[model samples]
Target chain A: MNSLKPFSLLKRIRERLDLQIALAILCLATAFLFVGGYLNYLRAQEQERTGVITMVREMVAVVEGNAAIAAYLQDLQLATEISAGLQSSRYISMVSIDIDGGGLVSTGAVQSGRSPDFVLELASPFSAAETVGSIKVYADLDYIEKLAASKGRSVVSGQLALLLLVSVAILWAVRVVVTRPLGSVVRQLKKINLSDEGSINQISTRSQDEIGYLADNINSMLSAIHAAYLSEAEQSRRIAQLERKFRLIFEGSHAGIVMVDGQNRLSLANQAFQSLVAHLDPHLDQQEPRPLSQLFYDPELVEGILSTVRENNASVFRDLKLAGEQEVWVRSLFSLIESQNSAEMGYIEVVFSDISDRALIEKHFEYGATHDQLTGLLNRRGGEARFRRQVEQAQSRAGSFVLCLIDLNDFKPVNDIYGHEAGDVVLKEISLRLKSALRADDVIVRWGGDEFVVSMLAQSSDAVDAVGRNLLSVFEQPVEIRPEVWVRVGGSIGIATSDRVGFSIERMVEAADEAMYIVKKGDKNSYQVFGDSVARSQSQA
Target chain B: MNWMIKAVWILLAFSGSLYAGDILVVVSKDSPVDTITKRELVDLYMGRSHSLPDGSPVMKIDAPVDSPVRAEFYQALIGMKVSEVNAYWARLMFTGRATPPMSVTKPEDVAGLLARNPSALGYLPEDSENEQLKTIFVIKEDQGAP
Candidate 1:
């Protein structure tokens, strides 16, 4: 009996890839063997049948003449001799001869070949045309069975041998093509170590098969992953360094720095900010931090700053006075710090410092840049800049205004006679008179030398005319050049307005100067308004 | 012509065989053919497609399968060996074609069987004559050869 090992072996073979191909070749070989064996068996059987028939016929032919003599003479011995002769053949087991009308002779039992036996009709060897006897020869079938057995054994053995050959070949092919390469790939995978210093990031295989392609792709993927890991580590280190630098800068900066997270709670405050907050309230708790609003004079100031930050996302609160006895003035910049990815994470940072002293000096410098140093009226350069601002206001608001030029009458004579001090006092007094006489929104400028210019917003041209007439009479009462020695000096005034044609600043100033020169020429100390001058000229024309 | 008749079937098989001697063709007295040429008899025997001149189908016969007259008849008819004729009939027999003629043991029965069945045809030695059957043709031996 075969053990169960062969069945288990078949299961193992079924799991393997080579079994299907091997089985296919085995089936073909088996079919060819079966067909070839059957055909060969058939041919052998036919040759055997033919041999038996031929042997029987030859046996009958040899004893035919004697069998005829036996039939003619009624001789039994002759018939028996012929029948006994058939036993010599290997295929012939028995023979019987029956001569007609004489005797019957038989030898051996007819136990051979096919059941009905092989019979041959013997014709008497004579020209007399007589029927004598018939002969029956039995054939032996052992040769047929033997031939079939041998042929069958050869075909089965051939198929078995072929099956074995095909199986071995398929197994070798599968090992080379499938199993060995996959084992190598698995071994390579087992060798991958990310933390090892000398670990390989690529498979070394250069084969052009599918396994090779798979290995290469896996290696490239591993390389990509390793690169990504390194890049991520590098970026994290950089972020840590940057955060440390930022903390140092924040702590060491001169300005008070405060950071508030997106939740509107104070997240960070530098030493300067805490000390400044401490300066705001002397009796504050030192153990806990204060709300950012407590450092300001008013709670509304913090609210306003935060609202501005919320609305415009950034704002500047200039000259914010800290709530302290020393009256510290600070300017603060409030900014919304957004996350890098623009996600919801963000905070607000306010950097503030004491600006009280600098603000005072800046105020003084601002006044000095635009105002006359001697009379405190606007100088020519600064007055022109103000004049452009006023012109823009006029155009944007659609309000009209006039520019007036006032020149001192004979001021050079007084300067030469009184040694220039008198002319200086006269010019200062004129600018003062102009500022006092004009509306609060009006601007007065020292036009250099003995001249002064004034800008007035008026409802009618007659209002400027009235101002011009008043300036002309201002030196009527002028007397003291140096205490009791007085020199009387009047003024010539010229005016131009937006209501007139060609209303640029330069043209307006020139038109006013032209009218003033006209007044200076026709009647010194008198005034000429450009509107009235245009009317007078047109009326003359 | 008589030499050609003997060699037509027999000499073609055994090219150096002796001449056919004293072969006679016969029919029943009631047969439509009182006489037929030797070539016409051979056509009927070999199953070639020819009608008797009277449009009658032939009922051809031969001696027992082992008879010498059976051998001589096929030798004259189509040069076939006796075994060759048996194989031919065996092919035709199993397929339900023409059955081989009935067998007779005695030579005298040849004339009696023909006389009983009018369409029966057979052969006899050339020296003999039968009252019950009519001779259709004679095949003389090659006695005048060199």
Candidate 2:
């Protein structure tokens, strides 16, 4: 069976190439042989025809003088004798001579319809130049043509036989030397499995001709194919291993990782990213892709980050608050994922790390920086910030507010008589009274020992006067400094309105202090407003 | 005595060379033919015409086939050997186209035959000519030697 396989392959190759070559050679050689043989037959036939004519002409030549003598003598008997002698040749059908006196002497036939093949002008036997008569010899054309045709057939057949022999010899040589070797090479090639490296085998040939060169070429080509296949297989194996390593990293990481396409839609989300998204909106449909922007509390913030990433091809890190039932914070890193092919649209890689605990601690620090410890209200630093905000609100609303500076009139004498603890108890009682008397949105601050500053929105002079009366009544009742002792400390108050002081906090406090000095000089425990006359005297002072 | 015989033999050879000269075609002096050309003589002997150009009917005679004069005469006249000339005549005679001329055995008999008929044509050696036969045409051996 194995031997038969090679033979079948050989037959297939032979059927395609070798058979065609042999058939082409046979067809071409046969056409040329027939044409050449036909031309040769024509030449031989012509030669045979000319041979018969030549023989008849030579026979006529031999009997020419006798016929001429007979013509000269006007002798019918001698003319008959000459004609009879010429008629003895097989190629001559009839012979005749014309006597000088216009008499005709013929042998075999008196008249023949066809033209004569040979005509000899009979001159006088005695005198060389005298025209005596003519003798015409008719050739046997039928017999001569038959002879020539037979000769032509023999020559053509011999040539045809020779052409056939040469064609067959060439066909046999081609089959032996060319097709058989090539077929064996093809059979060996079919057995090769290129994926199993080193399966390529060299073609074997014994001849040192063109067939040997062909085998060498085929072997080299097979080696090249095998090498290409081996490289391809190795490359695919390496790529699969690398893909598996990347998948492990993506699944195992704690940080949320997402790949977003050009449209800002999430293409691939790792388990960490999915969990982060679930924390943001537990009811979110995981089956359908959601826009990366919807995960943020502010879509505008997300869009700003995305635009920056597109323009710079750089990473943007922002601690963004996610939109959800509970406040979830994440530090998202937005970076461009570059496409390997320049023609493809790029993607973005986002990494989200939860940072809500850090955010809560930072908020506490922010609140501590702005509040007072002892009063549980805004300190001077905190009050300055509050006053600036109040000023901004007043300017925007086109309204006015009052700033009051209060100094205790008898606080120093009481402090010396009752000691420091009793003075502290008095200040605490006054602070509690101030708190109870003012509105909830008022700004109150302890300026220094025995001094206080308060601010409240007031749009009219009447409203300012009413607030002044309300502040003076806080010292109307004396405070119990100890369990059994009572002490009264009256407050001398001065007020400045924001419209009169022009929006500067320091200038407003200075104007109120000047007003309080005036009030202390006039009434020991009362309130005074810095009117246009006081502002004019102060500017003059 | 042997030298005298050798001299006599040399004399005979010299005379033989002299005899190989010319042959004259002749007719009897009593006939009316004064002169003839080679063409007219050939017509008469080769049997193309039996009458002379002047219209005198004449009989023709020949020397015997083996005679030297006959060989020389035919050779000089028609560039033929005696045997070829005989063949030509044999064909003519057998077909009954024309008759060949009567032949005489000896050279002297040619003059005797020409004398018997007045209009008789014959050829003889130039030296053998006599008054009874008039020379009309001379077949020169050197000019037409064949």
Question: Each model's interface RMSD (Å)?
Answer: 16.0, 2.2
User: Candidate 1 — what's its lDDT?
Assistant: 0.69
Q: Identify the leading candidate in terms of lDDT.
A: 2
Candidate 1 Cα misplacement greater than 4 A, ranges: A1-358, A459-463, A479-487, A531-541, B1-146
**Model-by-model DockQ, in order:** 0.01, 0.42
Candidate 2 residue pairs in clash (backbone atoms < 3 Å): A75-B97, A77-B95
Worst 10 residues of 2 chain A by lDDT: A532-541
Quality of model 2 by C-alpha lDDT: 0.80
lDDT of 2 by residue, A1-541 (tens): 8979989977875667777787689889878877998898999899999988888877788777667767888777767878988887778778889876769987765244677778889987666677889998888777889899999999999888888898888888887888777767777777777777656667788767887888888788878888988998999999999999999899888788988777787788888777866756644346776788887889888988888898898999889988776678898899998778764466889998878864467656766666554555556777888788888888887888789998986898888999988888777778778989999878888777888888987665467777788888788888888887888788888998987778898999998998889888875577778774432212110
Residue runs of model 2 more than 4 Å from their true location after superposition: A1-15, A108-112, A251-255, A260-291, A306-317, A323-328, A336-347, A353-541, B1-26, B29-37, B51-57, B63-76, B79-97, B105-113, B123-146
The docking quality of candidate 1, as DockQ, is 0.01
Task: Give the number of the best model, judged by TM-score.
Answer: 2
In model 1, what lDDT does residue A30 have? 72
> In candidate 2, what are the lDDT values of residues B12-124, reduced to their tens digit?
68866334777888889898997998877777777667788899888889998788778777778777888887887776555654667888877788889898899888988
Residue B131 deviation, candidate 2, in Å? 6.8
